[model samples]
Target: MLKFKTMLILLVTMSIYSGNAVASPTSQVVKDRSYYEERGDIVWEVPTQKKTIAFTFDDGPDRKQTPKILEVLDQYQAKATFFVVGERVERFPEIVKLVLSKGHEVGNHSFYHPSFQNISKEKAVNEIGKTQQAILKATGHTAVLFRPPGGSYDQNIINVSKQNNLQLILWSWHQDTKDWRAPGVQRIANKVLKNVRNGDIILMHDYVYNSSQTSEALKIILPELKKQGYSFVTVSQLLSQKDNPNTHIKVTQ
Candidate 1:
């Protein structure tokens, strides 16, 4: 009788240990999901093996430069996203229309292009709200993406974005072309091509001081990347690719 009781106790202990070991993977998965939800408001890039990327241009609808950029994209049959300022969109409504007419996506870049880091919540809302209205007024298309001017944001910006149902879009740090600096055409191309990878979101500007170089850089970048088996897509399209289990959807904080 004593021996049987001891054996029964040992078996119960082993069963408990085995159960815990089996549950460990599930517990770890829950932890990972929690961590992802905590920071899901901002997306710098997506995770995928397919050679796809997004080229996002900011401060756009420039009368001279935007048209040139559009022409190059059309030549390559590449699609991009333009984060246009509200006031700029108002001034160049026709350009905004042209951007949409060409099948490129438009996102709000704020009304006056102020950094959201130091702005009050009301001001941040105004900047974003005004841009959404302006874009709709100009192009009759509602923008669902918002890129804070200068890529600056805080909890307030994130909260406001959620309230407005806009996803906070950011670019991969490694893929910034810095074409706004008029880094020579070769340098701009190199900056993007050297470190680019699958699922990278690249940052460029349409209303830069030396805008012509951006167009020139695109002329080099679009074809070369295409040759390397990369497909240029808008931000929305990149996020919507199917069967990517590793993709994390951006959720409201």
Candidate 2:
């Protein structure tokens, strides 16, 4: 029993250490993008007013969660951005329609959501290109914004996005739901509510094991934000400026 207890303690320590190591990679990637690399024409985050936030859903247009999330937004009269994957959009075209019809914006999350930093330039182009075309065909609108898979990017990827005339978007803040672990709905909701601020961009997955939690959290978050004088807007609306024509531009082209 003594030996077993000692081994268990060691295992716990190792698990914590491993998690820190895994998280470090994302931080490193962000730092690399922020300074060491020139991101060309890709604007990582949108500038917005105080007390405003953009809620963006990534990897979605999902049949199950996307509709539920839309219903919640409808109840609050809130707007959001859905960064839909190309393959998924091809599979669930109706979800894209619902997103647009309901007043939400759709952006490109890529055709397959591959890692831009690791993939070749040709593959990177296809990743964004196919999705851009799919979004255009399905919704009859062109996607001007993109978020790279896993937030991994480099100079070549930025150049490709610029060539495609895309604005590369990233998050200002993240609510790490870890919903895949099936963390309870309340826990996810509280985490997001606690961390959100003005000019914040919250990231949540539309298709995942914990998608239900994401939907539930948004219901609580929207009302709470409203009470605090915050208005939910799609990414473009949140990032737009009166002086810049692109601010109010939609996908129609």
| TM-scores, all models, native as reference | 0.81, 0.78
lDDT score for candidate 2 against the true structure: 0.70
Writing each residue's lDDT as its tens digit, candidate 2 over 216-240 gives 8777788888998988888788766
Candidate 2: TM-score?
Answer: 0.78
Q: List, residue by residue over 1-253, the lDDT tens digit for candidate 1.
A: 9998896555333321121111111121213222422466766777767799999999988999999999999999899999999999999999999999999999989999875535787898899999999999998899999888766655677788888899988777677777777869999999888877888888899998755899999998999999999998999998776235555534211
Candidate 2 colliding pairs:
none
Evaluate all candidate structures by whole-model CA lDDT and list the values in order: 0.79, 0.70
Q: After superposing candidate 2, which stretches have Cα over 4 Å from the reference? A: 1-47, 174-176, 241-253
Give the number of the best model, judged by lDDT: 1
